[model samples]
Target: ILSDETDPNRLHDLKDTLDRYQVYDSAQIDELVGLYLSGADRDQLDPILDACVAAYNVGLDEDGQVDFKGKAKAFARTYAFVASILP
Candidate 1:
């Protein structure tokens, strides 16, 4: 998952990897985010959703659900968005 960090390598790199791999599509991403959000610690999904919003300009619902449609376009847009924010 992507996050706010003080590390040398930006978490955006990981999102890039996922994009390059084409493994985690929107459905998958939504599922994972939902899984994380469903817990008591919903805040844990904040940075992750921020990453998605950065990349896709799409925010999670108030209930923390990610729309899984248009997986590639959303992911690519989000990927570029996050990449732009890095460094």
Candidate 2:
């Protein structure tokens, strides 16, 4: 479990609650979201991107990076859930 732009103590608390599962800080999570968003199919990113857009209500960076607080949590959940289910 991880959270973007979340306090490190709170994130540590969350990880502790989840059997001490490793929790990534915002910066680490941002990288994952960036990679996923950049390489994934546009269709796959649509809902996530839309949700981010709705949350931030701002234009992306000139380099085309979407910036939104806590957006990485969604990606963390996606990765966590998928990884948990797969062998």
- Lowest lDDT 10-mer window, candidate 2? 62-71
Clashing pairs in 1: 55-78, 56-78
Tens digit of lDDT per residue, candidate 1, span 1-87? 234434434345545544653333586578666777677365665665566555443343432233333444555665666677778
lDDT of prediction 1 = 0.52
Estimate the overall C-alpha local distance difference test score of candidate 2: 0.47
Q: What is the RMSD of candidate 2? A: 12.9
lDDT of 2 at 87: 89
- In the range 12-86, model 2's lDDT, one tens digit per residue, is 443444322223345445755886868976666566546545534444443233222233454456456556755
Best by TM-score: 1
Backbone clashes for every candidate come to 2, 0
- TM-score, one value per model: 0.29, 0.24
Candidate 1 Cα RMSD (Å): 14.3
Residue 38 lDDT (model 1): 75
lDDT of each: 0.52, 0.47
Minimal lDDT window, size 10, model 1: 60-69
